[model samples]
Target: MKTKIIYLLMACIFLVSCQNLNRPSGQMTRVERVVSGQTIEIADRSVAVPLLEPIRLIGIQAPDIRQNPWGQEARIQLEKLTLGQEVLLEFDTQEKDGFDRLLAYVWLGGKLINEYMVKEGLALAKPDFPNTKYMERLTNAQEKARLMGLGIWNPNQPMRQTPGEFRSQNLKQ
Candidate 1:
């Protein structure tokens, strides 16, 4: 009876841990370029053979070229994260978005780049998926960076507005 109880408890723990929803066995590949703050084109398209696919780094949104003052900063940081670099790209089970960008987590030197963006306050942890792991940690990092006013959080920086929004707002009457 004692042995059975111990086994049951261990099984329960394993079950709980296994529920983490990230894509298992997602392949690693070499980054070809920093197409955007959250995306990189990869070289090893094993499923499609040399057809470079755009992998969107999961969990964070770097400043966009539009209306986010940190546009340059985001691009710069992302470049630093994976410019012609080799990194592990982990996928979400939901896979590609409607726009066809492959959703993934970019890991470099055992570090998660998506979470790093939030940690460094260069991005926000936009939660579209449930986290079997790392959500709280990501949020805490983003909060700390946000509080410190780093990068995009800097108040004196120029804000980002889209071309449409810019024209509407600043265009002369």
Candidate 2:
């Protein structure tokens, strides 16, 4: 009887522990930390939760600090919009990246921060990711920014390189 009781208790604990591991598809959560323009730490609000992984916004690629002024601008903009604020996280078909960061669409009030980044030209639309939930919207925003010469899109400015290119060149050196 004791053995059976122990098994039941273990099962109960396992089930409860799994509850907040993956939030319901469209659940909104508060931001505990903003790691970068593409990532943030979430406040899971459950004691059963493990170490909180920072979430990577699914379809936007922002400049890196190594990109100099542009990278700093993107990070600053993201910080201004998201730090200490509540956001809605929408998970994609793929939950976690190889780095274990949650892949999500971050919504701030009525705006999608991913799209906002592109709209402001602080980031570029990354269509390579499978979850294309807001791809069209993001691409459109990028075009507008390019047309209006916002952020990294100024015609007089040097061509803005994607974050991937920046990293690849760094690796070559």
Candidate 3:
């Protein structure tokens, strides 16, 4: 009887652990739109993708509303890049951030959106979480942009505090 109970307990633990790992894997989906700078829609047959649940372009950091300069332009460019395009999403360890969005690599045609933004000097390479495939590219892009003083790199650019910094400030409270 004790052996049976132990087995049952083990089974229960296994089932619970499996549940968290059951989120969606890498799935190719056409991007319906760029909801915001860090969010996107991956159309699925089960249902239309939720706007609130966005797939972040992992391993890259775009300006958030509270982040560095040119956030508006970053969002605008994201909108332009992803609207009505068929995008491929690659998922890593995190399914999403705290907002329940899907953390994913958004690829349009053959270009990796995360790397492109940084290379254009429109964003910075941030090692946000699990996805780091394009780290080198993102770094190089930011360096080139900074050297050129293009886009947000310009002296007059309005820079916003990063999410990390914001979180840290709040944490001290």
Candidate 4:
């Protein structure tokens, strides 16, 4: 009976440890590649074959790569901020989107990369439902960028359409 009890306790402990390991929040990972202005791929080393986990920055949207100068510019800016750097990921209410991409607020060197991108006018504040932990911060950053006439907000050369609109239009073409 004592041996069975010991085994049960050990199993309980193992299960608890597994739960913690599976939690996505507060995970520190290295950026393997920058997919776009608001998305990045991180190396998941937990499995034998390392997989690139794509993470979408919560509360922000960037131009599509085909959106002309803006799209390419956003990608380049995001690359400059996160490519090959270690970043901390903080998960929100909904961890993954329908596309299976992890939805997270990425932090690098104490800066929230999502908010920074909006503030720099490289992206827009786009808060999706159930994942708005930093929505206000991102919106404020975008406002500031607009006021400063930066990037997409430039009075002389503003972006013609939002990233969503651009994508939707492109789909029909």
Per-candidate RMSD vs. true structure? 5.2, 13.0, 12.2, 10.4
- State the lDDT at 136 in candidate 2: 93
Task: Quantify all predictions' global Cα lDDT against the true fold.
Answer: 0.71, 0.82, 0.70, 0.91
Worst 10 residues of 4 by lDDT: 19-28
Q: Lowest summed lDDT over 10 consecutive residues: which window, candidate 2?
A: 20-29
The deviation in Å at residue 117 for candidate 3 is 1.4
Error of 1 at 77 (Å): 1.4
* lDDT by residue (tens digit), candidate 2, 1-173: 99999999999999988986644358677777767668778765676874566898888888877787788788888889998897888877888888988889988877888999999988889874678878898999999998999988877774456788888998899
Return the top candidate by TM-score. 4
* Model 1 misplaced stretches (Cα beyond 4 Å): 1-25, 47-49, 130-133, 158-173
Residue 136 of model 3, lDDT score: 72
The sequence of per-residue lDDT tens digits that candidate 4 reaches over residues 80-119 is 9899998999988997998999999999987999999999
- TM-score of every model? 0.71, 0.78, 0.69, 0.84
lDDT for model 1 comes to 0.71
Query: Which residue pairs does candidate 3 place in steric collision?
Result: 67-160, 68-160, 69-159
Ranking by lDDT: 4, 2, 1, 3
| Candidate 4 off by > 4 Å | 1-25
**Model 4, position 126: C-alpha lDDT score:** 90
User: Ten residues in a row with the worst lDDT in model 1?
Assistant: 158-167
Q: In candidate 2, which residue pairs clash?
A: none
Candidate 1: tens digits of C-alpha lDDT, residues 3-97: 99999999998988887644334576788878767778877556756777788777676656444556667777889878888788676566787
